[model samples]
Target: MEMEKTTDPTSFHGAYRMTPATFDELLALVGPHIVKQTTNFRDPVGVSERLGITLRYLATDMSQRDVARHFCVGRATVCKIIQEVCQAIWEVGAPLFMAKPTTEDWKKIAEEFNNQWNFPHCLGAVDGKHIHIQKPALSGSLYFNYKRTFSTILMGVADAAYRFIYLDVGSYGREHDGSVFAQSTFGKALEDGTLLLPQSPNGDLPYVFVGDEAFPLKPQLMRPYPGKNLSDKKKIFNYRLSRARRVVENAFGIMVSKWRILRQPIIAKPEKVDKIVKAIGVLHNFMREKEGLEVECDVGSESGMTDVQIRLGANMYSGAAWDIRENFANHFSSPQGSLPYQNDIVQRGLNI
Candidate 1:
């Protein structure tokens, strides 16, 4: 059934859950694709109306049935609109917003890391987020993770600016980050030397991503020193790496704050949840890239290291990867790379 034409455009706050300007601008960008025609029984739903429904669905996290009743459309129509809009967003969105960076892009990102965080030889920060969802019927413990809940993973690589460059969603929550990373194409590319990372800015450092210990170590991926026997140098490296990696955490925060859809356990099917996540992630990058820098979302710590992290230790990567980690560790101690606070903090002598 065609959705009843909204008599008056939904208020900036009521319809799309954002300022009218943002809604108009977003509609202008996407409206051409999602517009529908009015039929005889009902006036065709305008693009903004359909777009409003989708945005409201994401912003309010209201049940589809409720959204339908309020908008005078079938619940199925609401679902269809959501799926369609999300798909539309992904098609145009994924490329412009989340497409893999060019070689020059990577160099600029690396330069930012050096200037901003003093972490050299870094490409991006990588991490996995648990997107909670309803358990499938009679699925036993298949979806259950160590957190004792059903979820899927959102593994992503974030540049220095906290925008997602690559993402993989919908993997079972029961999996650990190490396992998830091992299976992902992104991981395989990074491991096999196909990621086309920029060479060491210093001529000695290989571009790498900073991640928590749950991620596997690779010549291209860096995790902090694990176990309690860390040296002062290791502590400095850990602190610096942790700093660069905070961008991912902030990215998740900003995502949750703006797209309240992700704040709760999503009520849709796992497959639908995947599109919703992708759409939301893509929208976030689009907004950041075009709409300007986001004020960090006050979403607290929804992105804290998950049970997946606690359950898995760092992979014992060897050969080039091991040597690479050592080289970075040494680099962090050098005068050219070391931040002033690293030494005092690593020594536990910095006092408030």
Candidate 2:
């Protein structure tokens, strides 16, 4: 019997985090890559079973041994299957789901942020999350973080609809988001002016990615104003930026909420963990397209290395960067750019 016949549609979704039709579509895309040849000694597992096993492993926190038992397979087989299937998922699905955006795509993303989240000249929201993991052999304090956990960082750039546009995984957890970005491939591209970015709608102001206080304020990136402020204008800008930055947070939240494997420490080597993280991110975008699971509003409490500690990360900026931020702050408070509820939200003492 097929997996679908064994359960109802709701139960099927609960197990795989995708509807039956979505699973079939994903299988069609990913099956060819993961299919194995049958040997004369033993028959190969069916492609559907392989995909189902991988999805079950991701959808729940079940250990490999438990998953093996549930599927009536050996624990070693389950381990091998998950890694192979996750790699295939990333290779086959990433292009279709999370392809690199062009300059025009960046403009479209900014337009979506304005229409959906009310932030302008914002290409995307950037943030990082630590994927908890057990300490690696012979590695001490390298993966340890302020949260007192061993982890690998997964930094992502999220569009307004909570889809990941860019992702960098396998950074050590000890490094904060700002330093991680500074060292990331995306950061290097942005610094060297290779990454294609759309011009600002107003021309004078450049398009920027909104991040939390942990990120540096560059001409292309916007972080909130630090410390308690008295001026209502700064408060409005902070609130608006927070509202926009929340999309990345929600992206991470929805990923974790759907794929429970990230709910706890993933017991694997850092390299293996990298494949798993990338597969999860690619699958998230695929689900958004195939399953129509766009997150319209923020979900759960805030995450990432933002304001968790009393002292915020140092804000690295140049004079030009500061001027750009000031221009945005001024625009956010001005009549042309201001939202009617922005002032009220800031005045109501809500968390920005």
Best by lDDT: 2
Judging by TM-score against the true structure, name the best candidate. Answer: 2
For candidate 2, what is the TM-score?
0.94
RMSD of each: 3.3, 2.4
In order of appearance, the predictions have TM-scores of 0.89, 0.94
- Model 2, residue pairs in steric clash: none
- Put down candidate 1 lDDT per residue, 229-346, tens digits, no spaces: 7788778778888888877777777777777777678888888888888988888887776655544456335543253544444667878888887888888898877877778786
Kindly report which residue stretches of model 2 are placed more than 4 angstroms away from their true locations once superposed.
Answer: 1-7, 294-298, 301-313
| Global local distance difference test of model 1 | 0.77
- The lDDT per prediction is 0.77, 0.84
Tens-place lDDT per residue, model 2, 147-222, is 8888888889999988999999988878888878889999898899887987665755788888888888888899
Least accurate 10 contiguous residues by lDDT in model 2: 302-311
